[model samples]
Target: MRISQSYIILREVRFHAFHGVMPQERKVGADFTVSLRVGVDLSLPAESDDVADTLNYATLYEVVKQQMEIPSQLLEHVAGRIGKAVMDTFPQVTGVDVTLTKLNPPMGADCAGASVELHLINDKTKV
Candidate 1:
């Protein structure tokens, strides 16, 4: 039997935040959705069935929540911050993908949302 890399995902974690270049957007705020994909080795946890052997997703959510609360003008910045924070906090994570969506942005044209996605690999580890 071969054990390979596995992912722990948190999807559509929504928040209302003031994150935009426009003053009105900052004042009124808007809905934002965040999704994270965290990659790690699952062999230990698969065998031991121990929570301690795997990455704790609750902790990752808290990290994302903290970053979201700090207002920023660009979703790119927010997404980058999240990727770095997750990689820094969890050395076990070999790679991370972060998606941030801003619902009903203030553009003149009708649109459902705007989003930024970032993918990062831990340089410290060979993945």
Candidate 2:
């Protein structure tokens, strides 16, 4: 078997969501950026020129959006949820690299804000 690595990268997918330790953050919400590196085999789509042969990114966006809508106390938790959802929803997906960022954090630091990154492997990909 000729095994190779292929990835679909989704960048700067933004959402306004309630996720934090502070009450104000939960009530007012804040902007978040979600980027995903999805591991999948795209060789089929590349050959057939068919959308059905590939993982539809719009569906992946919806999955992330759904997870964001649910309130959470930590970025790590939310990111983990997103990674798991992708693995469960698409059998073709081998893994997910989730980077979730909280933009304009309530903290006084003048910075781009905080982020959590996670790499999750799909067990289904293992023999």
Candidate 3:
């Protein structure tokens, strides 16, 4: 018998935060979008129909919100922190992928945004 893993995803969670290397960028802040994919075992939840058997997306949002509140110089750092925090908070989660995007970046080009994606797997499941 084999057990299949499932995911709880939070897509395009937006926030206005101060995170940048430039002084003005920090002072004025910028728009940020975060997308998270949390992997977990869904066997129990599928049968029991109970929220307890799966990770709560609301709680995950709080974790991301808390991390975003803390300013960082780079999007990579923010994405890494989100992935680590989600894995630490949910014991059942086997892995996490976080995408953090900064809208209207200060680069002198016609672009929508810049982003960083981080993928982290639990140590026990690492191969």
Candidate 4:
């Protein structure tokens, strides 16, 4: 089997948190969505049929949830933190892409929300 590229995704993980520049935003908080695309080499896991050979998705979620609990002034900051956390905790992770969205933003726009995306490539991924 040839696994040219492999990644795991967690889509639309929802949370309510205080993350904004405005004071009211920090006070009232807002609904948010977090999506993650995690890159890794799936060759070992594919053949071994073992969770130990692959990333632990539950651990990944805990990492994300921990970051989300921390209040930040910008989505950029939050997203970057999440990406870095994943890379730091998982040596098997090759890359991480994080997307954070604030639902029904306080800003005076009719749009659904505002978002920020961050990407990080692991320098310590195992060969």
Residue 78 accuracy (lDDT) in model 4 = 96
Give TM per candidate.
0.94, 0.95, 0.93, 0.94
- Once fitted onto the true fold, the runs of candidate 4 whose alpha carbons sit more than 4 angstroms away are none
lDDT of 1 at 53: 88
For candidate 2, give the lDDT: 0.92
lDDT of 4 at 127: 37
Task: Give the per-residue lDDT of model 1 (tens digit) for 1-127.
Answer: 6676689899999999889999988888899999999988888888889999888889989999999998999999999999999988998889999999998887876887899999999998888
Model 2 lDDT tens row, 41-124: 988887889999999999999999999999999999999999999988898798999999999888899989799999998988
Q: Estimate the overall C-alpha local distance difference test score of candidate 4.
A: 0.91
TM-score of candidate 4 versus the correct structure, residues matched by position: 0.94
Cα RMSD for candidates in order: 1.1, 1.7, 1.7, 1.3
The collision pairs in model 2 are: none
- In order, the Cα lDDT scores of the candidates are 0.91, 0.92, 0.89, 0.91
Task: Please say which candidate is ahead in TM-score: 2 or 3.
Answer: 2
What tens digits encode model 3's per-residue C-alpha lDDT throughout 45-93? 7888999887888999999999999999989888888888888888778
TM-score, candidate number 2: 0.95
Quote the positional error of residue 10 for candidate 1 in Å. Answer: 0.6
TM-score of 3: 0.93
